[model samples]
Target: MGQPSQKPPSQKPPLQPWGRLLRFGGEESEPPVLLRRRELTIGRRRGCDLSFPGNKLISGDHCKIIVDEKSGQVSLEDTSTNGTVINKLKVVKKQTCPLQTGDVIYFVFRKNEPEHNVAYLYESLSEEHGLAQDSFEANKENMFHVTKDTSGAGQGDEPQFLPPLPTTQVCFEEPQPSTSTSDLFPRVATSSMEPPAGRAPPSSPDGEPNPNLHLLVTDQGGDTLSAPEGVRAVVEKPDRMEEQLTCCICQDLLYDCVSLQPCMHTFCAACYSGWMERSSLCPTCRCLVERICKNHILNNLVEAYLLQHPDKRRSEEDVQSMAARNKITQDMLQPKVRRSFSDEEDSLEDLLDLSDEDSESSDVSQPYIVCRQCPEYRRQVGQLFHYSGPGSEQRAMQAPGDTPSTSASVTPAQDYVCTLQGSHVICTCCFQPMPDRRAEREQDSRIAPQQCTVCLQPFCHLYWGCTRTGCLGCLAPFCELNLGDRCLDGVLNNNNYESDILKNYLATRGLTWKNVLADSLAALQRGVFLLTDYTVTGSTVLCYCCGLRSFRELTYQYRQNIPASELPVAVTSRPDCYWGRNCRTQVKAHHAMKFNHICEQTRFKN
Candidate 1:
């Protein structure tokens, strides 16, 4: 009975291979194509419903773009009195004008009453009015200084100085690339200097205006763009914008973006996480990579550009108008039908409204030390190390057991004020500025009170303690009940090689003796130490083939300049900097030529 239904091993099943396979995710997964080449935006923009409510500037067919398939043209329509513009070109009412690549379409909207500044879709090019007239490459960040009205209330709108940044480009158009076989990508301007010097003017063959700002004409097939000399067309060139400022991941115009580094390619915020999930390497440049670490500059840059895009501003207006209109409609329908809030609901709302946390002011104190080693080692801490003292630099120069805490000769307590200490955490203690209480608060503030490094969860340190590697090296809190001070390092078991285990554990966790000693008591709690070997090991290996190093590595090595016999052979003979692939080969060949037994037998073939 069990074998009755079984088919013979040689019998083939009936085949029906007629249905089509819709391939999605797998090895053939869309072939990792650029999002643009697929002719699509990562996400569709949601168009607002027609007709909005109170204080509404424009709604219900407010802005429209009609695409004509026959003519390959796009026509713009704006009900707002100001105008509808694609790029900066004002669209004539019914004209079906041909659209070019990278065109920035914008609409201007001003509310009926004199309320918020006219909610325009796109800002103008005038650097004066923040119009989009500046070169995209040029620094266009504007600065303003605001002053308080001091009427004993709070912050005021009155400004002391409305200072502006160096006026530059609001937008830039990348000229049509040459037809020749030379590299198509725009070459980054070369410089003679790498360190922080100043950018100098480039020498032009024509000896004319700055090429960066000049109106260089481009030949599109036989047709040439014939705008007035120095009159750059802002409206007609979204293609150029697409080329220069597109998100590397989405291939869309960068809305809010962030640049991935060591490879400085920028990608839209939505796309970056996915791209980084695959690999953090910049998609445009095929270079080695690191993780998506902090990038303040790129974050700030994208934030600024997104502030200018008008599409989002207009959408927000639609939602607000609808809400207002609905409120009015409800009031008109039920003038006398007010619903009382439930007692339980009111109680719940009150609890939710209460503040769990506020933007509590913190005293950020900084202390500085001289030795380059400690400060350089403390890049994870950043600017604080520059301004704050008590680093590897300070520790080395200190007298034997010279405590920073004891050094502070305290005066009697005066008017109570908050002070940020030299350590990293914002002062939880008070409202006034925290002083570098180095002598007083050195050891106690090393780490956050009871946070565990593994779980990042806080525990009572009294019960918890270092268990695996022993309490000597692993000061991490764990309980003797949960974990006895069992020594993986044998420090508790008293192994002869316990120091080796302790060193390895500390190196892996970036918690060396020097780091612990230098940290302010507060820093230890928050965990603000560099998670890397502070000691410049035989220098860094930038290019393994050539044995090269980085500026930081050399800086660390030359800093001490230990005698050759004492230092490792690698640190002694390492190449100063990264040699390009070609240069590295040439240099290697030259050196090998001097020590070739094979070359001695066979005359040089190269």
Candidate 2:
């Protein structure tokens, strides 16, 4: 073949620098991703090249990007639940749309989810006839050098040298005039020159120095010339003395001043008292207030100052009046006492008697009263009573020593009644009837009633184990068996210990109880009585002979091959006809004959 007559060498086309740079996470987020590949897949799935795990609205296979290398064109196709948006417009699903430089892409149309949106900054390789790539590489190198130089420049006390950054021409829009005088100067340009040594630059009419450089010359005597009289110096005035003494809560002059302990921060007694009910921290320093006491000295001083300044007295009176009204409203909303008993006729007498006793005594005279709800009693007399309801004469006639029983005829006026008659109080946890305190006191004089730290309700330790057990985290008395044991001790209603134990056992083995429970409940909900325990040991094994043989012959083979663990522990199918056949009896007979195991139908309990 004449050594293959020398053919002309073909020149390879120059590799195009065209690629899409995806800028995601907005301005305050992470850096963008530079896509060098011709194809890009975006979705929540791990297989996708660009995954958006933070976007729960996105589907598993959301969208795809295809780049045409020859044409330098890029396109995106949406295959997601919410679909995608291009340049603020929704893109059709499964349809490719060409994307250009500066095109914005949103995974979803939801304006609330800004994190899923991205912008594109395209760099066309063909720009400047292939000179774009060379310029980009040079600019990137310059940026790297600038970054490295600036990072190490600010370390020493002496200023380090930095290469001057390349300058570019900036265009400004036409300025519009406004009422403000500052708006007149809108085109001030910056200069590289510095002012002369030792002399300060001249300031503008606003008294602020001009940010731009200005040249100034000083005389031989070194005396500086003052700026033109048009520029006036601004002076700030001191705040009025009364402004410093204003209470933060009422925003007025302090009255009945009370100082919070530890910090000694003062506030109006009524304002601080109401605030202390919600939080025990000082309003100023946020320090814990162990206690708050009336600042008599400060109170007298403020009083004297107000007396000297009569104009402020009216404002002080208005604030004090408002505080008083707020205190009254709060008192009305919160119950003075948490009634122990529910609405019932038999408990009406005891509730009325307690209310009567409370009304008879002054709140200040009584120490803290331990009630079902409130731990303290400091409200006005009779505030806790609800006496509008009809009284029960039968309950009133009954002796105090008699044990009260729930009566159908008796009805209570209020929702809560004092169930405790004389000394008989109900258990806060279990609601179990406790022995009379009079009887208990006679039996053991030294023993006293214990109280729950959380509810602050008194419960007898002798009746319900002990109320002293408290949680370390909150220091609150949480019933040990109920909270600590997850209520697995059958203390709560409908508690199933067996089910709980099984769930705990599966959880310990790395199996989720929710999955197992969901699967089991689904079958039960479908009315499927078959009890199938799919253990870790895959599927049940079947004999080859049984597979080929008839149903009658299969029974004998099933007996020989079935495992003990695979056998159903219980059946839930009805004994009556099911699908025109007795499913319960059939399953029972089949299990009994095949595995020699007894089958008992059981009811499913939640």
Candidate 3:
């Protein structure tokens, strides 16, 4: 319920008249409503203009015009009078509504029937009742309104307060009242340039009607207020702000942080310089770096967040948080952005294949998670290592070769911890406590694996059989049960054969040898490079035969070095052996074993 908007007239007046327009909301055809002397109580409803005067209903007091612009009903309540009646019913204002054409209302001032004065400007409704309308108005027709100068104005001529109605409403054709805002404060309805209901506003014949046209109002006294068109706009106050990223260097803010040319990656002035020093390209886009800018929207968000939390200490964590927050902001502004998934998830097929391969080996060759919750890294290669070189002496001390393993001899770098097992790794060599398996695990009680006596490092057995041998000197982990021939029980751990050379030579002349057991026997074989004074490859040949596995390394030595072309070829039953010079008798090629004894003691002699 509001009055129609008014446009400024071209005819000038030095000053506008003081007046307030009455707005009608109820229907006009129906007779105006009335009030009775009944609903009033002891306490008056504060802040309301209509109040009961000691058990009496009062109307036409401060109310002037009674008209209806809309079809709604209008009424009032007497909050103090107790004798008031609405249609012969004694109801409080809380119960009875205002008067209507068909409904009868009664009011009495002490002892008489209250008179209904539908007067427009009676003493009870105008300035005489201490009720005066204002004349102040802001000609909103002109977006930019300029008021008249107050200087040289005559006394008693100036209006007290002007109705600051946004007068620009007349420029638009659509009619709408500020119902929402009206409840809050007295509001002046504004017209919209939108087409009028049922029909559009009449346009000029030449089209583009009233271009450069503006609304201006002038009073008879030469006072003027003109509105500049299209100047007034809805100003939006910031509702909320989001942060995105931060500076890598100072961690303070990115100054002149221009978004990268290609990728739109934002960075500060000093940061880009530092980054360019190492590589000439944008940190984000990887584009060739030619120039940079200082003002970047992304970086601005970061700076703003850090600025708000002044007491917060900046750190890698803070930087990361800032980056995540800023990313959300950026994504909000620009959706359709791509994001990367976890490496494991992305290469799921490869990981599954690796798992299958490891399953065959009982997870021995499988990889373990060093720390499953390792913070996400924004850069590639999520880890760093200390290599052997200058400025790496600290790492050398930590992992010294001369020292034993971390558990016993050597140490490891702080950056790395063993991850062979959930929290422990087993060594295949010396079947002892291994450091490699002492990695973190999901389990509370971590079980570490033991070391192997063979490799000294942790291992998951790929081959079957017991490889835990006694000859650790050769780093073999197998017993006589696993190996076919030659029992290495004595020579592997501590030789327990004869202490003398000659005695050990004749000890086991020829029985099927699988394992050795005598410390005296090992002692007897000491320094006796040759088992017998038999004809050799012109002298003697040494064979370093590996007992743990089926492998052997044969080395042929001669007093004189001769080229292969000078040697004579000979045909023989064996294909792996060749003839040597001097001592004939073929000697079964370069070297062959002739099991013979000092006397007739050996039965399998040749």
Candidate 4:
């Protein structure tokens, strides 16, 4: 009877679909299309699985969306003439790229008239993906908001599309008309070289009018801008500051910014980490990436920018993806020893017992070397090493067959003298004795004593500072660290490579290294160059090459600000180079000597 009443098997719930595409920012919004099939074709023609008849640019078979069964990874294959854009990145025709959740797909991009553009907001339907279809549907009304361009380009006539970013957009309405620009904007300026109104133009210390100053005066009507008397309107177009805040690798705003050392160029930590897996060279400058450190300053600036432009902030799913890929950590910020101190430091009683056991087991004495510069040295009985000399201050070899006692000795008749001869390391820069950190190095290379990154030679400045036992004055000067610029060309002159232009310029100006330092100091004092908190005028936390780079940059800025009257007449009279510092012609001594490379490029693509 129990077998006859057995319950029927319960039906299983339907499996969640993998992907969906929601049409956005056109003449009208449409319901999202589920990507249920393994491969689906999209086009303008009726034969295609996903057809958009309104889009004239789409071909009969424009692109194919593919979903991997096992991995749940979705990818897009573009086959259209107009091309497909995934999150602002144009996909090469016939190539496939894996699509991430919240990626925007554009069949054809029309910068103006976004309403005419064929666009789709890609969403992964999985709840674990953090972009469930219901969440997108719930916020559908406030999804795509087109606003006026804030870059002050084209008189703010063109509308800016915000849907492609896949982020939360807090709508910012137009500010009410106000007399004060500050009321309307945190910073407001025309896309011109003319300095903003109300701020005094920078002048030289001698009270001479700055030749570089191009102040524009607006009429009372405020409809037109005009240059002052004898001041030519430079009419330099403004650069898009927004581009500077984005990572070149991801083509998105930076997150967890990390700077590539030697180059000092910053990028998103997760983006750069992915790049590093393929190659160790910096993507922007092509410089060899030596070390990476968090760019705290740039991170702060990025946070500030995101606060102002909330729409540019990445979605939670994108943030989680990037966090998983991030390789840089706080541990990379500082050097650490290989082993924990707790493991290295045992009880004194235990150490004494071990020493006694060692003494009883062996007749030969173990040798230990101490730094001569150390403050105190004592030869304890049954110790690993012993010092023998007639004078307490002088160091010599111990007499043969002089066995050390196993027991502790009485108080010394005179003050104990520190010996220089036993088991000490020599400072790479000063050739002076210092404590050996070999034990720490043996445990972990990252925690090893400070050394020159280029030559791999140990320095005592950091080692002595850490120990807090040696005199600071005994350490070598910071300059011995060989501080240089990003390229490290002029300062680190080798027979293999040298900057001829730098050499000739120094010679022409009758400037020595001392003069360069003086000018850099003067630049700092005059606010021509600013230093971070970690960096002092004479001391810096940066490595030798980086420190030198700071000085080199400051020196260049100082030289650029100097009036023509102060410079050589021939140099001032030389025609300005069109390509500026980026000129390939500068490699030739004749071209470098003929034109100034410190100024901005006058000739650019229109």
Scored by TM-score, the top model is 4
Candidate 2 lDDT: 0.38
Put down candidate 3 lDDT per residue, 63-158, tens digits, no spaces: 111211132222333321122333333222222232333333333212221232111111112232122112111222231232222333332121
Instruction: Tell me the RMSD of model 1 versus the true structure.
Output: 31.4
What tens-digit string does per-residue lDDT give for candidate 4 at 490-553? Answer: 4421211124344456678776665666666766766767654324555333344445655666
Model 3 segments more than 4 A misplaced: 1-423, 426-481, 485-525, 529-606
| Runs of candidate 1 exceeding 4 Å displacement | 1-43, 48-245, 253-256, 312-606
On TM-score, who's better, 1 or 4?
4
List runs of model 2 lying over 4 Å from the truth.
1-15, 24-37, 51-59, 68-73, 108-110, 113-606
RMSD of each: 31.4, 33.1, 32.5, 27.2
Instruction: Tell me how far the alpha carbon of residue 527 in candidate 1 is from the true structure, in angstroms, after superposition.
Output: 47
lDDT of 2 at 518: 39
Candidate order by lDDT, highest to lowest?
4, 2, 1, 3
Candidate lDDT values, in order: 0.29, 0.38, 0.28, 0.49
> How many clashing pairs does model 2 include?
1
lDDT (10s digit) by residue, model 2, range 1-606: 000011122276533435544454445454445455666677654456666543334554667776655544456766543345554434433434455556566554434334433434443434542453454333322221111112234321211111122221112222221111112223232222222333322334553322221111111121223333222222223224454555666545677777766687877767766765554446666555555566778767777777777755633444556567444222111123234433432254344433323334564644334432121221221243335244432333222212212222222212222332323355554343334443444576443333432234544333223222341111111111112223222211122322333434445667552334334334434544233322211122211111111111222222223354533353212232222111233344343233222222233422
Model 4 ranges with Cα > 4 A deviation: 1-389, 392-458, 461-511, 531-536, 541-543, 603-606
TM-score for each candidate, following the candidate numbering? 0.20, 0.23, 0.16, 0.25
